[model samples]
Target: MSAPDLLSFAKAVSSGAIRVVDLTQTLSPEFPIIALPPEFGQCAPFRLEEISRYDERGPAWYWNNFTVGEHTGTHFDAPIHWVSGKDLPNNAVDTIAPEKFIAPVCVIDCSADSTADPDFLLTVERIESWEKQHGRIEAGSWVFLRTDWSKRDYKAYANLKEDGAHTPGPAAEAVKWLVEERDVLGFGTETIGTDAGQAHLFNPPFPAHFFMHGKGRYGLQCLTNLDQLPAKGAVVVAAPLKIKQGSGSPLRVLALIASK
Candidate 1:
């Protein structure tokens, strides 16, 4: 297929020839934040206070004063979020090139596996199997691990247990292969973070964040609606707030699906 010009692409979207899917979980105070040890600094939850009412404070308008952590809700992770990427250029949300926000994506569905085992970890063999069916995972494409984990309610979504939250994610080797071999633009998940719940147990810990970002890639968390997309071809739009030197930021995620 020939590449569409910017104007042509706009017209196609405007004409409904291309459909947009909301991949974000709505941000609200009810949404759960990533649980951390009591000793460490924690991310804040979304909060809002209405500053005006039609009767008195503001007759003409209604407004709100809001506060939210950079990583709250559906969010993007910049390279600088981890110490490994601390010295890399354009590592923050504001500094990264805007062109990085849009890219092709590959959806690897591990729904059945994840459902059967809460601690499921994607391995390199599984990724190779996916490639056997869906073609190569091209460099610069967003690779999303679809565990159908987002379908759960707020309680099950986090799946916190005495041992820590039970969740599915890539193994350290898988993360390494995706970053160094497949060269994905980023790794995304339906959970609160790109890494698995038990990732800390791995050597160097949180390999997804460590390898991906350390090498100048990105991540998306709390994503939804992956079942609605094809295994390949969808283009993801993940633009984050340009927070100055910020580690990360909450952002709306959208997927453009071709409707031929």
Candidate 2:
């Protein structure tokens, strides 16, 4: 009984066998924010007024009442966020199945493509090539787009200049293929949003958001640390705060990558 090594995975608690990788960007005022047209519902950028920094408000406590968009920071997107998935059961973050919050992940390296062009679209052909090397993407695992964009400066990360943000994302066809064919649990990105900067020009527009939500898949954005994981076998933990009737919520995402 004292031999934890004899148990199937008690080794998960053993030293040097597993590691936790933080996959969230810092929720700071300087982080680039998502943009919405002047007419649509607006997503507030994160802002906090220090209630007390170990001072008057509460001598022993330092906290703040902050206002942030449901999609702000390292956040999760529930199906209910878009009208396309509005009617589905458990469509909101508060209602989603808890089991879905933890799962294995596949980080598809797309940083080179993104570096070559800010508007790059992750295509099925590239995924197919990845599979050729990494094996078929297992169903129900997360497919994280690892572009390392989270490492860029705020101006470069957003790449916005009057027209809108310029970022990499899945092609519309690729999103459809992933949802319908690969059966991925969700999509994640290092950029400000999951869709490309100019996705409004694609058919049905914002295809990653459209198809992922419509199919009841989830989204993780404003992510980092993809550079810390291998292509396969990392288990991700992304449990959002239990906000009431939340369209979505910011969260701390962690990944458990296997060690040598």
Candidate 3:
């Protein structure tokens, strides 16, 4: 089969045959960051400093300087983020191939399960069930876990308790299966981190980070608008900032979906 025509694809999007859905969460001071134990260094929240306004330093144009942690808000995680992948070449965002920025996606909706239990874990059995109906997940495609957690308000979104955060994510075995069995491009979540909030209790701890990154796969966190996309046939564009030796970076994720 012939490859898709780039110009024609762009025209389709412009002509409304294809709809683009923004999957990124808005970056703001209120957007919650992952909370680590007190002994660990904490990621900074989004902050902005007014460099100029229409009436100020630059009358012709206005701009502001922003400061934020690489992993703040909706972000992309590179392989280097975890010590398991630290020694791998091209593990950092800047070193990753640009070709990886775009890929096909398979969204597994677990909203009902997550709603029933915030600590819900996406097991291999659940993934198999999804595949049975939607067809097998393709190789080199991103596997997104849609929990509808992005729809919560600030307080509920974080869902932090005295013990820690309460959120849903894939089980350790699921992550390994997706990477080894499916050869997926990556794993994504609508939560602050790719791993479940209580994943620390897992054998390797933060298994998503451990297995995914360790094997040169990627991760996307704090995404939104998964409800706008189909379970399959959606292509995700997740381009992170080219930060040198950086573990991760906030990104503007967009999904291209064909309109029936």
Candidate 4:
């Protein structure tokens, strides 16, 4: 964009002609984290310790020390998070180009289906149906599956069961199609993961991670307020922390949309 175009955008933002939506869920100990079976390594939940609260430690200032897993709450997943993209260059969070952090987004609303069946898996047919109405998903755009999962209570959000959590996600074929055909920059979800809870049963399990990361694409999870975004036109700003060789990290995701 030219300097004039950039200046107009800045002016629009200041003049309330554009709106900004926060897509990140608040990071707290109460927020649910992805659960793994006993045999597998686990992710740590957000934890904080008060270093000073204007007491003896600090006379007039308050601060804290906190610890959290790389993929804790409202996180970004780099290609290196999975073995499929382990060898890919610039696959880690810090190495990814900064320009990649901002891109147009396509929000696919599957709330009705998700509400009807928690384990509903998005199919290519569904995507095509969406495209028929909204237009084709452009390359290098973020495709966010809006399941309204972020509105559930902590336990209900996780929806853990004897077998596993029963959450909605894209089918393997759908994921493959998104990566190979559409060439999306990444996938986003309001659920705990980019894959369905029962995705383990599918061939090449966790296909979203498999195909997306395998192609040096990205993933965002535990996102909220996806319903606030339009099916097209909105741009997402999802820049993760610059952790050295990090697989993934919690991030504050934001969306910019035109007000009028």
- lDDT of each candidate versus the true structure: 0.94, 0.90, 0.95, 0.96
Give the number of colliding residue pairs in candidate 1. 0
Tens digit of per-residue lDDT, candidate 1, span 85-143: 99999999999999999999999999999999989999999999999999999999999
RMSD (CA, Å), each prediction: 1.5, 2.4, 1.3, 0.7
CA lDDT, candidate 2, residue 105: 96
> Which candidate ranks first by lDDT, i.e. highest?
4
Candidate 2 shows a clash count of 0
TM-score of each predicted structure versus truth: 0.97, 0.94, 0.98, 0.99
* Cα RMSD, model 3: 1.3
Candidate number with the higher lDDT (3 or 4): 4
- Model 3 lDDT per residue over 142-223, tens place: 9999999999998888899998999999999999999999999999999999999999999789999999999999999999
Candidate 4: clashing residue pairs, number: 0
- What clash pairs does model 1 have? none
Give the top-scoring candidate (TM-score).
4
Candidate 2 lDDT at 198 equals 91
Name the better of 1 and 2 by TM-score.
1
lDDT of 4 at 22: 96
Better-scoring candidate (lDDT), 2 or 4: 4
